[model samples]
Target: MKTMFKKHGPPPTAVEDATFRIRFAELSAGYAGHPVLHQLSAGIAAFTSTALVGPNGSGKSTLLGVLAGVIQPTAGKLHHAGGRPPAFVPQRGAVGDALPLTVRQTVEMGCWGARGLWRRLTRQDRAAVDSALERLGIADLATRQLGELSGGQRQRALIAQGLAQESDLLLLDEPTTGLDPEARERIAMLLTELVADGVTVVHATHDLDAARSADVCLLLREGRLVGQGHPRQVLTPSTFARIWQPA
Candidate 1:
């Protein structure tokens, strides 16, 4: 299984000229008979930062899951600018694998998802991994074991792992959950840099500040789009009140 994704890994296809961005038309996703995302249609422009916002159980994470290809949409088309697979960073605690590995080793594992086993990482691969660590300002922490890192440091390491993959599209879920305000700011700054480098980022978060920082904000409610556009337009106080009415 591992060897197949390495030597015979999917070919690197160029971005299409005609794609305005990634488009999902009439998309619906859910399990069994309950739909988590219903008739969703959104266009995520290439290299832009789009944020998903909603109250609890509003399907924000479910939307990100669909974008990351972790969950298949029950209906509609999802078109991308390129054929490249996306890098996914689910909520902080989604992955809890105990590997007894250092931060650097863990970050390098990003390549393994696509690079597979048997084939050694190339010089370019190593450089990408190093650059990702440097970008996250965790170069010094590289040799430290994952078990020894703080929550913020571990989160940064996971993001660095995503950066190492160098996927054009990145999907993150609640990226700054357990971090302090300072760390949160740092992560936001790093995300800005990633956007500048032409990476399209779509993430889910309940953080109001993070929502404000996004180029586009999508508000979800009961598997429906409450609003889709700028933060000011979508995150009005009234909208919040409606989404999370008092029980």
Candidate 2:
């Protein structure tokens, strides 16, 4: 079966100056006959942070999975300016506790995108892994088992793996979920740094404060996009009532 996402030549000239990192139209998905996203259409601005906010079952994770190319979308038209796919970082607990992989090994997995899984890491690849570890502030825990780390540490490690992928776009599914406030703030700062480095970041989260910090906010309601614009405008009091409460 063909995936909904398709990499193509450069975006058409008309949208070049429009400043969108990614754009999609009529996207839909399902899992075991259960519909997720509807015919959703939206665009993520270039080099900015975007937050996907909605109540449970709003299809945030599904959309992120579509963008990441891990989950096949039943239908959609999509294009990314980067040409290459975005790096996806799942939540901390996604990695199993039983895996014998160390932190460094997990981070090195990011290089598989650039270097094949069977290929040995070059000097540059090793450098990238080290750089990612340092950037995530987990260089000291390089030898630790993934399950041995705290929730925040594991999350950082996952982000480091994405950083090692070195893609222009990033998709994180609730990266700050279940973390201490300080840890959440730290991860938020790291995301800001990624944007500063010219990386576009998209994250689905329930943290309204984090959503407020994003340059763009995508409000989802029952798998449909309800709003797209500055956070201050899209995440409004009245809008919250409409999406979170009974219709």
Candidate 3:
């Protein structure tokens, strides 16, 4: 079957910008003996949303993992200007739901990095959790078991957890996948608000519509950087075909 999306013209070359939150220089990473991401050099703009797009096995998740500090690059260097750990929200399936944790408990976990595992949450910590829940509009569901909520609700809860971390940078992997249109829109809107508030968001996704909403789009194929620039300008038909079409 043909792909669900159409393509446009070739994207213009990426322009170097002075304001960047993170910079990857010749970054390369892999698992075991095999490499998934090749030498990739790119910069994520500060206080903006950047979408990582490509077909499966394109190394989007790998890149995100590197940025989140969960995976070490086999070669090259990744530098973060903020010098603080970023909040990473993996795909919902990655999070085990059998733990019997409530939404509030889950969201509060975001503070563990700052407060330490054994340290008690202070009044300020509690307030941060409250604000995160309220920000995601999940305050009413605070006491609900995470397993009981719908996919959309659960996603919001996870995002609330990320927000509770209060990190300047947020990394998400397919946060809008397998959701209704309304749910996707809600997530997108929330991301926009976060970016406006000086939070940098980078999400790896296959959704073109979601990619278009980002301030910057980074396209990858076979773990190599294919394109990077404004989505409307970079994600053209020719570019999509090059990335998505079978050779």
- For model 1, where is the 10-residue window of minimal lDDT? 1-10
Per-residue lDDT tens digits for candidate 3, residues 56-138, read 99999999999898888887766676545899999999988897999999999999999998999999999999999999999
Best by TM-score: 2
Q: After superposition, how far is residue 243 of candidate 3 from its true place, in Å?
A: 0.5
Best by lDDT: 3
**Number of the candidate with higher lDDT, 2 or 3:** 3
- Model 2 agreement with the true structure over 110-229: per-residue lDDT tens digits: 999888999999998899899999999999999999989999999999999998887888999999999999999999999999999999999999999899989988999889998889
* Per-model CA lDDT versus the true structure: 0.81, 0.87, 0.89
Off by over 4 Å in 1: 1-19
lDDT of 1 by residue, 1-247 (tens): 0001112223223453244457666677898888898877777877888898888888999888887877877776666667457888877687674769899988898898777976789898899999999989999999998878888898899999999898988889999988899989998988888899888988899898988999898888888887888887878888889877853
Position 123, candidate 2: lDDT? 94
lDDT of 1 at 176: 91
Model 1 residue 123 lDDT score: 92
The true-versus-predicted C-alpha distance at residue 167 of model 3, in Å, is: 0.6
